[model samples]
Target: MSAEIIETLRSGRLANLGLLSDDDIQFAEATIKKIVNNGSETIRLVFPDQHGIFRGKTLSVHHLVSVAANGIGFPSSLLLKDTSHRTVFPIWQKQKDAPDYILEGALDVIACPDFRTCVDFNWASNSTLLICDLYQRNGAKIDFSSRQILKNATTSLQLAGYKALFGLEVEFQIFRIIDDALKHDQSQMPPTAIKTENITQGWQYLTETRYGEVEEILEELRQASETMNLGLISTEIEMGPSQFEFTFGVDEALTQADKFLLFRTMVKEICRRRQMHATFMAKPIMPNSAANGWHIHQSIIDLNSGLNAFMASTDLTETSVSSNWIAGLLHCARDCCLLTTPTVNGYKRYQPNQLAPTNVNWGYDNRGVMLRALIFDGDPNCRVENRVAESAANPYFAFASQIMSGLFGLENTLVLQPATINPYDVEATLLPRTLGEAISTFHNSAINRQFFGDDFVDYLTIIKKAEWDRYNSRVSQWEQDEYFNNF
Candidate 1:
């Protein structure tokens, strides 16, 4: 391991560390030494991919120092892939067409470990964990690195003397594992009985009996979160069968994203050990069931003044900076849809009267609106809740997109439309109905390109277009059933 990792491990105060750099590897080595003392010699060097899946290699403690110094190697092509793991970029084709250029085709990439994320492996017998960032051969950050995008966005905000504080309320489904192979079949996996039992029994809100039913599972998650030093606020049974909602305390935007990713992984692993499966897919089981969403609550605090910019007034009113912020979120709701609800399945949740917003509108204490203002007159902690993102969304990209959009609104002093008493009947525009439409809007937005950079936007468009193309080619059951019988 590097000297920094060694020093980090020796400190034993891992939880309080900030963003990790190459110098922190000494601290990590000290941490590893402590783990070894406890008799666990295995460590997983994991990194989040484009789809937010954790991918990495597990190394022995004996090799930690060497791996930390040199970094672990992964394929460069991983960054050029879509959600389905298809290489969307035409790197090979371009190289083949131009033989004079030096294109090694499949080059090796490195994942530099982030030692500050070092946490004890709750599920492993004797192991610790770390997250990494992918780096190109020339030591340049990959264009599609979600974590890097968020870091860049934070840097912009910090430069303006403001800080982004984020809190997440994410919903997901948990199913009992009946059979390994059969469970892989999406149709038979959710088990309708699970939903019927939980929904039909009138478990609309959190109650003692409902909590008792899943006490053991919830307990395990709570313990695991505490062990990992995750700032977990609360977790409650959701509306759907085996569905649950987890909330986290407000933190810096990037740190909150990391915590969210780790917490989701922990819940899935713990559920699996108990013969259960947890899915973060936006609309896993369609129709008849309420869709799951990841609601993001955000605010901007003045770094110099130490005041929340989104809060106004000593009493609830019609005018405030908070109201203007809500206006900004609603104004860019259509353009922001691509980042918030990026997947095709995500659009299915925007149905009328489903508690999910279908149009770009704001309302006070209205969950049916895309932007809900949560100011209680003089509450300093008041902020805006954006209820558009799907659970599968990359938090970094999603949060960064929102920050840029809202910042634009704030800078322009945009006037928001009047609050709608009935969001469904309001005259506001609706969000993009499909991923294709959302991508089109995103690609056409000059402002978005200006904020996120032309190269990054172009790369994202190409990759996501490939995903849409792949999805379009596959014939769905609806098409087969409808056409096969009629035609």
Candidate 2:
């Protein structure tokens, strides 16, 4: 068993191992010394589910031998589900067609762990951690795997001789704990709370005093993040009261998504411990409060020469490859709306005077436009900023969609329309008006189906439709007041 485990670790096919028991850790150490004679007690196994949530069970160093003997088991339905915990697909329906199929049985899937993300599991009840990839019973890769999806998109770019780098700027609202009163009475109407600051106002944009007010909370968050190995860049006070923005250093797609999920979990847990609340809802409040957006900054690098592809030449005015990349992003703005601003509430942030883009356009260093080209002439590390995405978007899916759309643009040499002087007044293309409109556009888009694969496209659509139906079935206060009196 030790020999087999050592062979698997040395193969380099699996980068990380998971947490194990004390006995398992000892066995793994012996095996490692025998194989390479240099034992390192570390492993990481991570599995990202349909909602892009990382769920996994880790092993200790001694358990590596036993883990190699038999793979860990996880629920098969995790892949074929939606956010509501409903199984979106008819897995059993296919079994009837193929009598040999036996999916109703608790499907056993293998978790191929990655070693690169291996780190200490100090946050867990047990000291174990590992990042794993899902493989089918037949050893085929799971189609709905979020990591695989991002990997596929990145591979496509690599084939085109370019590598992509991702930076995430996430905004979320924080609320202080008050009485246990319901903010909304579902039986009647959702009540709104008036703004009253327990602390002083006028502290904005990383002000020293602002950090002082929230020092204890922010300090706890920073410590938790550091302990968990989450690469947090900085945190700042946002426009709304108690709203905050957290930034992280740029990384690969999968790593960035993993880090983002970790950050969210850390913030929520730490806030709960401190008797506070955090929400990523795009527009938690309407009429007055500022809307939150997740600004994704991405740059492509050349694999061969290790040069930034989005960089401009010494002469700034000359059109460079970076311009074409920005053009690609702007060209696919409308079609990519479903992935970026996914939820129904996300559209509320796209209003004309909301400081969010209402038109499909790009401009140099412009925040109003959907795409912002942030590269200067002779700057080798230039990149583009996509401001269209809402904070509620699934990072993996959103980033993957952008990669595919941008790749398509690059492949076809898509030309971008000139930057709008006034994006609000420009007669440029508009994003879908509603969830139904976005769904219809996505369903009808052959290009989208082709890139995302028909199975994935169909499954996602079905799940989204379920959510939409649920929302549509609900009665609103406006409907009650207008119709109850008249009819």
Candidate 3:
């Protein structure tokens, strides 16, 4: 805020924060100046946590140049919090078991601007928002940060001479607000779930009239997505009450993940403004409620030939590279289930005959199997769509799991089984039935340890297990109804 502080920051205050390239430093300097000259009032410095939620600080325009130069400081405990806002790690103890944590006593973690990810938040009155990367005081990247983990996976693919492109077909629900818990006591850590009523009677399944009812809100979302560069392809009414699906065009895995989070946050904020509630929860507990799934369509590009690497030949006799990827996905699906469906509620969507995959199998353009191959012999757009993911997943972790698993299959030259015609009846392993099972599978996975390192795997397991423990401790209505009176 002071001239002396600005002068000190501009004169290399962030030089010791990390190893920023000259180009990056220059970009930050110029961007700050541009924002100042544009009369921007605020700058939001945000970082994606393990749950892919954006948490950060807002700076007055006067402090932009100084804060951008020095890097914004935030408590590292933000990364330690679970979905319930509980700090899972034992920070008070010696913490020798958790070495990755530098946040004992809630120490400061530096957040530096990712210059490439700067966006003007036009919906928020043109305030600039810069996505940040977390670092220790010594400049080491936070290994467990969801964005960094995704970057690691993408980098591995780059080294393997391939590029991954991902598209999204994510389904969610929207309802008219009945009541928002605004009482002081209701402002608990995770916040109380707001009560909502159906926007439509549903079950119409993409009918014209069903779409027309919510056309205005859908259009508003589509336009806002365009403003944020979300590459939206289509929006339609899904089968269940107040359910909707949105499709996005293909992009590199990292960019798609960022866009997906942004889209989710944007939709929720916009809907709230309209006195409606939009949720990406996999399966909201209601009578006859349909499950929401996030189907990711992916393909790899050959760096050498600049062609779709999955296409082996038009003859259709030999096994294509894509098949190997599918094999890997199936082989690793169980172990990686925690990454794709991280929450307890997510596992509830994987039910038989529910338009959600329950087994580890692939099929030719079949939606029932976990992996649906839409490959044509000569089509450049041929790709595989993974249907195992839930709408509530952190896109970064989910995409990272896909890349790592597929890479393993490709590298090992794994053989594929015949496509299953009846996905439910096939002799295949069922996916994990609960979050606890998924965490156990992930923890003991040799392939996961080999790729993600034991530290990363263990770090995830500890936090997720805490959530599971909380759930298990609760007394459910089902238990109460069956035992409360009878027992």
Sort the candidates on lDDT, descending order.
3, 1, 2
Q: Which candidate is the best by TM-score?
A: 3
Comparison by TM-score, 1 against 3, better one: 3
Q: In order, how many clashes per candidate?
A: 23, 24, 0
lDDT of each: 0.74, 0.68, 0.85
Stretches of candidate 1 exceeding 4 Å from the true structure = 1-26, 95-104, 182-203, 312-321
Using all chains and alpha carbons, the TM-scores for the candidates as numbered come to 0.87, 0.82, 0.94
> Lowest summed lDDT over 10 consecutive residues: which window, candidate 1?
95-104
For model 1, how does the per-residue alpha-carbon lDDT over 385-480 read when each residue is reduced to its tens digit? 888889988887898888887777766667777777787874668889999999999888887777888666776777788888877987999999
Write down the lDDT that model 3 would get. 0.85
lDDT of 1 at 326: 67
Off by over 4 Å in 2: 1-46, 57-65, 95-106, 123-126, 177-205, 285-289, 313-319
Clash count, candidate 3: 0
